[model samples]
Target: MLKLGVNIDHVATLRQARYRGREQGEPDPVRAARICEEAGAHGITCHLREDRRHIVDRDVFALRRTVRTRLNLEMANTPEIVAIALQVKPDIVCIVPERREEVTTEGGLDVVAQEPALTETRRRMNDAGIEVSLFIAPDPPQIEAAARVGAQFVELHTGRFAEAFGDPAQREEELNRLVEGARLAHRLGLRVNAGHGLNYENVRWLHRVPHLVELNIGHSIISRAVFTGLARAVRDMLDAMAGYTGGMPGAA
Candidate 1:
């Protein structure tokens, strides 16, 4: 079955927006993550950015202690985060490209350019018994680089594919790239996990992708919670994903 790793970074984002370092009357991301897990999230993902913006250090530690399901910690290849990850030792560590200026992760890590950094990072995480994943664009070179760096998984950046949702021509092109990228990665013995800009409307389309082990979605699911509530929103997405397993009829 295709697993759903719900990203809870944005829940902390909303909390931080109100608290703004004051730390009062804020919804705890750990609690929200537990809710998502109870509602059927296979795992929880939180990115601890360089700037203590959304998911702070405390949130990561709390989630580590509380989340029963797999914990996928997204971080950059930096000394500070590396040390923290070694100490916390989450189930998985997904290395991604980060920029303080960007509102969110704009795209995947450029593994080709940062090959040495990725290689060393993967070694450190693997030594700590942590599964290492590279959040990379659906490019052959990047996928190849991930394999060379001994990454356990490759999370395809689906932002561009999501953006081209309504355009048949553009969507087809982007989807083809992802499909091929997944195939290539699988052949290289790397587990495939994808996410970025995936929402209810476009998520089912990902069913066409083969060998995809997981999808780490956040902003869309959190936004939907504003109306449907967290548990219900997570369940709805799980139902959608369940429909696609075993190629069940009428999944879309």
Candidate 2:
């Protein structure tokens, strides 16, 4: 079955907005993670950005101690963050591109350009027994580069697909890109996980893209929690992810 890795970064975003520079805050992300796992999420995801935008060191460490399910730590391939990952040792580390200016992650990491550095980081992560995943756009070169770097997984950046949801032609094109990306990644011996802008309505279309192991989602679930509450929001996403039967029949 397809799994849901509930991203709790946005819950920390809300807390930081009101309580930045404070010692304590309401709506703790660690607590939020426990609720998500209890609601049947397979894992918890949080990005510890360099700028300390949302999920912070405190939150990451707290999650490492508290999360019952797996912890997927989203991070940039930087020296400082790499060292921390070695120390904290989350279940998996998804290497992504980071820019302080963008409101959110604008796109995937260019693994082709940064192959040498990324390969080293992946090596370090694996040495520490933490599996490495690269967040890349659904393109052949990036997918191939990820395999070359020895990444265990590649999370296809779904922003473009989500953005094109309103336009039928564009949406189909984007979906095809993801389909081909997943197929290539699987054949290349990499596990597949996708995220970024995935939500209740648009996620139903993802069944077309085969071999998805998990979807890391945050903003949509947190927004929905305003009315339905966190546990219910998580359960609702799992419901939407139901009935996926894996798109490629005999391919693993």
- TM values, all candidates: 0.96, 0.98
Per-residue error for 124 in candidate 2, Å, reads 0.5
Clashing pairs in 1: none
Count of residue pairs whose backbone atoms collide, per candidate? 0, 0
| lDDT by residue (tens digit), candidate 2, 177-209 | 999999999999999999999999999899889
How does model 2 fare in lDDT?
Answer: 0.94
Candidate 1 at residue 15, lDDT? 89
Residue 172 displacement (Å), model 1: 0.8
Could you tell me how far off, in angstroms, the CA of residue 110 lies in candidate 1 after the best superposition?
A: 1.1
Per-prediction CA RMSD (Å): 1.7, 1.9
Specify the poorest-scoring 10-residue window by lDDT in model 1: 243-252
lDDT of 1: 0.91
TM-score of 1: 0.96
